[model samples]
Target: MLNLLSNLICTALLSAPVVSEPANPKALPFEVSAYVTSENKIRVAVEKSAPESVVVLLRNSKNEILFQEMISKKELKYAAKLDMKNLTDGAYELEFKSAQGAIRKQVNVATKPVAEPARVILMNTPAE
Candidate 1:
């Protein structure tokens, strides 16, 4: 009987306790969208969710940087428009960097032939 109790106590003492560590969390926020205008100009819209300053960079498929600029905003959302009239038709990428996060998005710009000048007029007529 004494031996059985001793074995039980020894088994309890030899068993290890499970320990858990707290997890570390971090903030991440960034977005980018690209669109081409009717005049063949590429417009890149950048959105940020942080209040800290950020840098927007544009690069081509060859890994060559085309343009870069710094922006600062107090709000959580902000946008920056880039004009690419002189850029060649190809695939491009936009890199967004902030104090908290960094993101990249791919964009494609197609070539358009030159045409005659035309005017666009919007007429609003009230209907019954």
Candidate 2:
């Protein structure tokens, strides 16, 4: 009886389910950088570990798409330029899409009122 009970206890312990922790999701292996030039153009740079074709889109605050473009190349570096001069002065979004996924970053383009040029004055002075 003692041996049978020990065997039963050992079997119960061995048959117990093992608890495991969940695994975290993998992150995207790419980096996105954006810049606004002095000429009111938005330039987005896409850098990735592998070569891929990227699709870029610009949208307004209301989620309406303003411009879209696709770039295909063998290299990992690419740039997308968007003209913001025609767009209204407000907040905007630049979205980068590729085989991995899509990433968005906010961009603000504000325009100041144009100022008129001032008159130039030329004075002639005699050297002592």
Candidate 3:
């Protein structure tokens, strides 16, 4: 019975699906990616190297910083969102700075405000 169980385990391990890595791996210690997660809000993802803190900076085409923030990193995979309301639509850059290095990505802000769904609530009053 023990031998049979060992063989079954080995077969299962051999049959398991394997996940392939990227053909071209990133040479940078860390990677930062940005996308429009919501209307007027761009979501940024930080992955790869571990970091303590990161500086989030929004810059215009002229390389002038329009907004900035220092965020503390708690986990290896960290995410941040930037509000793009009341800003003109055009090319922009989102820069994330850390001890390892900084990564910048170009993003265009043309997202419209997301429509919020309606909500209803019922209230009950007690006798005075």
Candidate 4:
């Protein structure tokens, strides 16, 4: 019975349609995200449609604005970066608003600084 089941499964899988081509996703109207560094440096990215006025703001957990900037889109696309340092480690939000739309992204700066991790552990490793 196990052999029959395995043969049937293999047949069905081989007959299944193949999705070899991947569809490209459309970009959002606006986006706001932050890239935090372990050295306590935060780089904020704001992307939006061209020919629109965009307001970028960084606020603390208490909704107090820490940084604010206004950008006028005079090209086909617009992107802005904010280098934030010397800020106390805490939760914050980066906001991008315009006549088109608004996007908010959270920024978590735990007391223990952290950035992207690229290392992985294998199960075969000996227990320390």
The CA lDDT of each predicted structure is 0.56, 0.61, 0.59, 0.54
Worst 10 residues of 3 by lDDT: 11-20
Worst 10 residues of 2 by lDDT: 11-20
Residues 21-85 of candidate 4: C-alpha lDDT, one tens digit per residue: 22211233444455654334555565654467777777888999988888767533445544444
Q: Which has the greatest lDDT?
A: 2
Report the lDDT tens digits of candidate 3 across residue range 16-111: 111122322353445666666324466777775654677778888888999887766666677776666556757777776766556666666543
- Top candidate when judged by TM-score against the true structure: 2
In model 3, state the lDDT of residue 106: 68
Predicted candidate 1 versus true structure: per-residue lDDT over 28-124, tens digit per residue: 4545555544444446565566557767777889999888877766555555556554566677777766666566666666544434569999999
* 1-128 per-residue lDDT for model 2 (tens digits): 54333322221001111112112113444566776655556667777776677777888889998888776757577777765666666777777766666676777656554445699999999999
Please list the residue runs of candidate 3 whose C-alpha ends up more than 4 Å from where it truly belongs after superposition.
Answer: 1-27, 73-75, 110-128
Q: Which residue pairs collide in model 4, if any?
A: none
Residue 40 of candidate 2: its Cα lDDT? Answer: 58
Clashing pairs in 1: none
